[model samples]
Structures are given as C-alpha cells and as structure tokens.
Target: MVVGSMISQIELVLNELPESEKKVAEYILANAKEVMHMTIHDLATKAEASSAAVVRFCRSLGIDGFPALKIRLSAEVENTPHVGYFDVESNETVHSIIDKMLSNTILTFQNTASQLDAQSIEQAVSLLQQAEVIYVYGIGASFIIAEDAAQKWLRLGKNVYAISDRHLLAAAMATKSENAVFWGISYSGETREVIQLIKRAKEQGIKTISLTRPGNNKLSQLADVSLFTSRAPEAQLRSAATSSRFAQLFVLDIVFSAYASAQHDFTVEQLAKTRKMIEILYD
Candidate 1:
C-alpha cells in the first residue's frame, strides 16, 4: 500500500491497538515523517516505549518490520512538507520585530505554497459551489477568518453565514443537512466547541471542511476534507499566531477565487448587479 493508504490504515486502527502499542501508535500518528528518520532505538526512546514494543506496534499495523514502516513513513514525509512559524523575543527592538515578522511570514507563504495540492483545492471549490448554504465557525482569532469566508461567499451571491454565538451556531447547525457545508476554522484543530459543532454537523449529514495547522489533531480527524495551514508554535510575543492566521486567510482566499473563476460569467454578472444596486442606493 502507499503512504497515504498506510496513514488511513493507521488512523482506522489507532484506537484498537493495545495500551503499550497505543503509545507508539499515537507518537507515530503525530510524527510519522519524523519517526521515519529515527532508528528503532530512537523511536522507542522518543516514544518512551521499548524496541520490542515498537516492533509489536508495526506488527499491529500489518507491516513486515520496522524498515517497512519507516519506508512508508518516509514516503509520506517526502510527499508533505513541514511549515512552521516562530515568535519574536521579548524586549526586542522595533527593527528586530520587523525582521522576525517578515522572516516568519515569508517562510509561512513558502511552506503553504509547497504543500498545497491544486486538485484538492479544486475539489473544495466544487463542494462550495454545490452547497445550498455555507456555515463558517471559528473562535477567537479564528472567528475573524470565519467572518472573512462569509463575506467572500456572500459577494459571490452564495448563501453564507458566520455565527459568532456558540449556542446559536450549534442550534443552526442542527437544522442544516447534506445540502449545507460546515467550515470549521481552528488553528489548533482541537477547539472543543468547534469539534462539538463538527460532530453535530456529521450527525446531521452535513459535509464538513476544516482549515487548521497541520498535525494529528481532532479537527483533521473529524472533517471530511482537511486543509492545513502552516503550524505556528506559541510564543511570548504571540507573533506566531499573527503570521499563521494571515497564511490561513490567504489559503481561504485562494479557494474562494478558484471557485469564482470556475463560474466566470456568472460572477461577472453578479458583480455588475451588486455594483448597480450599490450605485442606486448611494445616488
């Protein structure tokens, strides 16, 4: 099987592994590519398990041995590039802050561009195009992203809503079905309220998409389509969040534009009509 298939397999059987094996499983799931570069001894040490346990874990996954597992992991690592954001230091001068933020933002765009798959993006656009309604949900800083998504879709004459109130959003979701699409934006991919809403959407048969930092997180596990932003580690200055959020929003804009272009004439007509309405109101 290919690396992607192996990943799906691992996700499927993760919870079924024995306790000793579960530790190894969790670590591998979280750091598949990193583990590929490590020796059995290294993996055991890093996972806080034993070499024998590592072998057993591989066996549970139906791989021949550690080498085979490593090969699969290496394939996955090579296929997916890692992107990370750094924070500025406290007491840094103004010039230093500018430099650090610039470096972080540049790296973020580079990393995000490298990992993005055009086909998956097209699929996302297709889903959005077919949906009767789009509901965007996020918390805190991510709420800003949700609002941005709503505004973009609305501009295209799509029925889009961004609900800031957690209770009202959950209630609204309960009324939506497969015709609706729920977009959950969370940098951590483990926001409790967002996760709950995702589950509710799933129960109601609504398609779900997630935009989050790449990691083995709850949101990715739950969503139908998972679009990742570059991971941004926490810092005292909170510069990481600032850069990562911009990167996430950029990816969202790309998806929206792709969808709009697919319906070029319709989009043009919609824009013309909107402009005319605004002109009439203003005049």
Candidate 2:
C-alpha cells in the first residue's frame, strides 16, 4: 500500500494503534469501498469496535469524525480507477512490463490531481511568494525532488535553497529569520531529519511548507501549508517511490508555474538571462 494513502496510513499505524482501533482499521481496509456506505454502528458491529472507537479511528486518520471519514472514503472509492499497481510477474515479457509502467505513471498523475486540495495549494504558493528566502529539505529520494524544486524556482530568480546535509541544514536553520520559509519534502512525511529541521525552523518563527502523500503525518501536521501528491501502492520493485516522485514534481511545477505567472515580466527576463549564461558556458 502507498505510505500516505488512507488505507496505507491505517496499515502503517495499525500495529501501534489501540486494540479497539486496530479492529476498526482492519475492517476498513478489508472493506474500503463498502465502508463508505456503512453507518458507524454497522461498521462497529462488523469490526467489534465500540461507536466511540470508530470515532477515534477516524480521528487517528486526521479526519473529523465518522461522517467525515465516509465523505473522504467515498471520494477515494468512487474516483479510484479499477486499474492499480500490479507487481511484475516472473515470466512477463518486456513489452508487458513497459505497458504496465506507462499505465502506472498516467494513473499516478490522475490520482494525485484528484486528491489535491485547492485551498491548501493556494496557501502554499502564497507563502512561497511572500517568503524572502525558501529553504527546501529532503533526504534520499525526496532530496532529488527538493533539488528539482530549487532549480525550478532559481531559474525564475526566486531565492531558494535545497540543503541535503543534516548538520549543515541545522546550522542554516539556526540563523534563519521569520522571513525565510522551510519546505520539507517526504512522501512518508516521517523523515526524522526533515522533522528535526522543521522544528528548529519553527522555533525561529519560520513558517513551513510540506509535500507529502495525502494523509496525516507529523511533518505535515507541523507544516503551515501542507501539499499532497498521489500515493502509489508498494511493489517488490518499489515503484511506489518512483510514481510518488512524479506526483511530487507535478505539485512542484504547479506551484512554481503559478509563482512565475505572478511575476511574468521578471521571470521572462530572468529566463532570457539564464539562457544567455548557459550559452556563454558552452563558449
């Protein structure tokens, strides 16, 4: 299951969840689509959870209550295409493998787009635009996405930095002012290093932005502006991170493009200047 997806989140925290909540989570995962239409009491009976336990399960997911959970579950259930992540079979031909990879890429963008919250995105962009400097953080695969984010904004002349070193990041955060913003990118939203940096940034009154898979996570919870990407289920090949990367970049582009449009003349001039600089390097 995808790390940030609803079912996946329940599963990730299932082992640590209370016995009452575990029952509720198991029942929901087994009957995701059906749970959307089932009443709280009905689900409680099936899961052997008390009505209060059902409410707690919903809250654990960062949802308001049973009714809210149903609304969210309904959206995911109704909109999710029947096609999903499939593991490559041992004897599958190369052509079949290619087709599946391409399909998953297409579906990842579709799912991520459908799950995006417009208001949250607006706030994220606005914060970026207002910031005097933007510090992007990530580790491993997420660090690649953060670098891309920094590159995209740098071309537009935005003051952005993608810092991958934990020690250096902590040092930089120590001196950051309130005018600077911290953007943490982690698909699981639980990366220890990123979370620590965000905490430091906050102590200095720096606001934070987060790019994560849709659901509740500590990093996202700490962020002032939480942006989400599509969640892809896991496979033996671990294509979940691959598709999730695309979704993250997709969100980055949306925010970057919007920011560029707001300062079109400046961005155009900067693009021309950067192009000229590249040509000079070639000379």
Candidate 3:
C-alpha cells in the first residue's frame, strides 16, 4: 500500500477512536468494498453507529466529510493490495517468516506515513535547521533510533549528541548550546528517563520534539513538536522490536530526507566529504 492511503490511516488511528467512532471504523475495515458504494446513512446504519458518529470517524482519519472519505477509500481499495500482519505460528517455515516480516515492514511504513502530518514534519525540519545543538535521547530500543538520528545529523556537520546514560545526559544538559533542541524518542511515549530529560530541556528553555506511537501521551503533550509512528499490533514476533522499530525509523528517515532536501547543495557536499574521510581512513 502507498503512503497516506485512506485504509492505512483508519487502521493506524483505530485504537484512539471513541467507541461510537470505532464501530464505524470496524465496519468500514471489514467491508471496505461495500462501504465504498454506500452512502453515509447506509454506512452508519450497517455499522450500528449514528450518522454523526460516521462523520466523527471520518474526521478522526483526517478526512473532512463522509463523501471525501468514501472517495479516498474507493481509490485505496482499487489500488492497494489487502495486506495484513500475520503472527508466526508454531513450527512455521523459514519462507513463512520471511514473507510475514516483509508484510509487517510494508504495513509499518504505510501506517506510519498515514499518521504523519505534513505541517508537523515541516515544523520539525525547521527546528532542526535552526538549532545549534541537538540532544537526542531514548531508552531501550528507542535509544537505537536516537543514535541513528544523531549520526545522520552529525554527517551534515550538525552538533548532535545521543548519550545512552541518563546521568551522563543530565550532566551534558547543563552545558547545552544557547540555541538547542532536545528530541525524545519512545514508542510508548511514557519512558520515564525520556520524560525526565524532556522536562529538564523544557526547564532550560530548549526546544523539545517527541516521537511516539499514535494517540495522546505525556511526552507528545509536553513537546513543542510531536512526531508519531503507527501503533503496531502486538504479536510474539513483534515484541522483539520488529515492526515498531521499522515504524520509528521510517518517520525519522522522512524527517532526515526532508531536512537534507531543504539544503541540497550543502548536504551533498557534507556527505561527499564524510565519505571521502572514511575512505581515506580505511586506506
């Protein structure tokens, strides 16, 4: 499925919707083809939800109205394949594992893209552009994302720090640049250490950005700008940072690509310089 597909958007935000709106989402997801041909009243009736609930559901997925929702759904149903995440079964074949992982990764990218807001991405890029120093922090699997982001910006000659130790990060915060940005990454959006660091950054008047899964969470609420990943469905295989990490990386890659594009000449020069330096060191 393509990025920002209507079906993917609905699925990504499904858990956050109210019960009334959820009924509409559930019905539409199950009967996507039928919903495309149905009117708002028809859908509401079939879903056992009110017409107002149908409208609210549409809005929740970032659609303006029922008609627009149906139009987008119609296009999505025609062009997008019906791909769903499959949990591993006992005694599964290697082929099955390969296919399932690929499907999960594709779903993660599409769903995360669906939840992303263009304006928020633009705002984040602007913050990264202006900041003299950027402090990236996360715990557990998210810390990997933090280091990945720091390495990307560092290649562009940006001052970036991704310290794994919370105590060490706290110490560095005291000596932050005057124009600094703090980015916290946590899939659940409630990691204690990340939250504490974000609070400390706020207290220091440093701009803050947060990346988390879809829905309201403390970290997102506390940040000046918030980025989100798709809420990956839990599975035994997924518990090991498979789909969730893919989603997080997808969002950050988009941000980094956008930032690099905004300064194409400089980015190319920096990349070439870094590559040459590495080659020379290898020699």
Best by TM-score: 3
Clashes of each: 0, 0, 0
lDDT of 3 by residue, 22-61 (tens): 9999999899999999999999999999999998887666
Q: Write candidate 1's Cα lDDT for 69-151 as tens digits.
A: 88877765677554334467668799977777886787666555544567768778878988998989999999999999998
How do the candidates rank by lDDT, highest first? 3, 2, 1
Superior candidate under lDDT, 1 versus 2: 2
Candidate with the larger TM-score of 1 and 3: 3
lDDT for model 3: 0.87
The candidate scoring highest on lDDT is 3
What are the lDDT figures for the candidates, one per model? 0.79, 0.80, 0.87
The lDDT of model 1 is: 0.79
Each candidate structure's TM-score, on Cα atoms with residue i matched to residue i, is 0.69, 0.78, 0.89
Candidate 2 stretches with Cα past 4 Å from truth are 1-37, 57-81, 175-178, 279-283
Backbone-clash count (model 2): 0
Indicate the residue-level lDDT of 205 in model 2: 90
Count clashing residue pairs in model 3. Answer: 0
Alpha-carbon error at 121 in model 1, in Å? 1.4
lDDT of 2 by residue, 188-220 (tens): 999999999889889889989999986678999
